[model samples]
Target chain A: MKVMTLNFLTCAVKNCKSSNDSFPLHPKEAELAKDDIEINPQLLINVLPRIDWAALRTTSTELGFPTLPEQPPSPEDLQSDEALLKELHELLMETQMMEGKLVCGHCGHEYAVKNGVANFLLPSHLV
Target chain B: MLPTPDTSHVPYNRVYEPAEDSFLLLDTLSSPSETAFLSSRFCSTSPSSPSPPNFGAPLVLEVGPGSGVVIAFLTAHASTIFGTPHVLTTAIDVSPFACAATNLTVRKAVSEAEAEAEAENPSTSGQWTSAIQGDLVSPLRPGSVDVLVFNPPYVPTPGLPAPPPAPLQELRDKTTFEEDSHLLELTYAGGKDGMETTDRLIDALPGVLSERGVAYILLCAQNKPEDVKGRIRSMGTGTGEGEGWKAETVGTSGKQAGWEKLQIVRVWR
Candidate 1:
């Protein structure tokens, strides 16, 4: 029963290049789940308490998190939302995806994550 | 867990006394006792490394040093154990109180060592390591160290209502969750996601590590032990793998409620 919304409001909009760190995730990179990683269950469950349920639902979508039905989750929702929850789980949890590339939501930046390692550094002008 | 000079109960962002009771709270950590082993392991690597290229003059750097005690310990034994001719230690911290404490403690350690060295060599007492503010070094020089040690703020969740006074508060992060920004103190808290500071440390290490240089990091529950391994694995130098740089859990830091089961992890690179 966690809801999150994309809060691009707080990001450093000073420039588009603030989001390209790969190895150590840059603070500004859009938080989305990749193929080889899974969302942390504890972080997801814990965030259920601290985050805005409605906002979470909205932002996860914009951030490319899987979508679920609008009907309020029930006592059995944890079981029903299993598939979507896993998707949401990956969205909220901190993960180190070694393979694939991270696409930027703000800028058209694609950072590569290979061998469980991501190269986040961009060229000087991009920086 | 401790009171600042002002005795305010409000917590987070305050510098607490370094006594065993003040900061060693085990409320969030699984087992502080196990963590004590981590701290010991974090420290033990200094003696295990093959002598560095500069055995004649060992230059050591420490970051986020609280009271200079750890450096003092390393410098004291480095010569005999690490084959260092003379150790030049530099302890870095943002807190003036901590820096002063580090200066005094290092000097005291040097004097004590000099007292011992006087039995054989007279020059031992005069060479004391330098302590400066962290800002002094911007984007720390690349590959310039024999042993680099750091014990950052590794508190899991600094839920205390109010922050501590100046100097100490400067050491902690001023960011609130609303900001979604990071603070040095929050790095200690590790938040719901651990490795808050460890991530930054990892990003910085690539530039700081010397070829074949040794690094020691002290971590608590704020960091995920596995991630520490993961990042170390990513280093790709082949130094941290296969049981070489182990993050062993150390025992309690001698506190009251929390630290009895805290795990302090040490990373060597």
Candidate 2:
């Protein structure tokens, strides 16, 4: 999965919603790959408002990506600054969660990523 | 227009290359009207009409996008037809090689479209393409999908005999399942009249489809399309009489592959 979709993913366990760490699932020992995708600034700007910069920054840091500012860049800055747009593009589009696990902070559920696909199938009791 | 992304890049030895069934699915989705409808549906607060007459990019997710041809074609062209900034295109496959090939195919298609657009108008933007490896749509959130597409392993293979007793030899490390044996099994092994794998995906539709979402599924005549439709119509939120998901045989293709008759069915709420 791309880092972009990880932004929208939260722990989907039935009773796990009340937990604090439910919002941003933690990526542990994630092996990352970068595909050759062209950076589209306009598309990046379009999704900027919806992205949680802090969650992305934290996850990227854990996966050994370059540091992203805790605060998201302003819309004006995104349009004008090519460097910022390029950086965001690399983080969102190119980086792939190849292998490892995404641990749910709330319930401590481990979602394994083997061969770039995250297995989110919870056991029967959890569902 | 540039040629379609070369399927030769796909590791055919491990991945299932696009075939006649894939083309049948592609041919069925010729019109972009559903996407326009989806765009309107996204902006529509009321079921009748769009609120602000705006276009909201549709989220298109495909299950088992083996070669990623259909997803790439749709993603690269959605922007031009919808006149939207981006379309969230995702392809999920069980095989890791398929996922990698999908990412590569999407990237190549996008770059070609971008180059062409740039030559015409330098300010053109691109769309987003994501690939995930998983069983069906289990990883995706519930009721968020706009368009769900699937071309599952529909070939009915004979049930293999049970394994023989284990030999009394030294226990070696667990063998690599990725050594092409299991991969081939997944590509076309659909147990029990080819409905076993497809049925699992059907069970997931209600949870993954949005209130106004639609699904485009490739079905073999062997799976019994009527039964599948009836099953879906009586699923979650599809309970009441005349108040369930509607199924239509949007497209059909005649191809001789054992007892399978290829048909693309579009199911909508």
For each of the candidates, what fraction of the native contacts does it recover? 0.00, 0.30
Q: Which residue pairs in candidate 2 collide?
A: A117-B133
- lDDT (10s digit) by residue, model 2, range B80-104: 4335646677877766567778878
In angstroms, give how far residue B67 of model 2 lies from its true place.
2.0
| Runs in model 2 lying further than 4 Å from the true structure | A10-23, A29-100, A112-127, B1-3, B32-56, B80-85, B121-126, B158-181, B238-243, B255-258
Candidates, DockQ: 0.01, 0.28
Task: Report the C-alpha lDDT of model 1 over B66-118, residue by residue, as the tens digit.
Answer: 55555555555444433332444566554444555566666566656656677
Q: Give the TM-score of candidate 2.
A: 0.73
What are the TM-scores, per candidate, against the unseen true structure?
0.45, 0.73
RMSD of each: 22.4, 6.3
TM-score of chain A of each: 0.40, 0.90
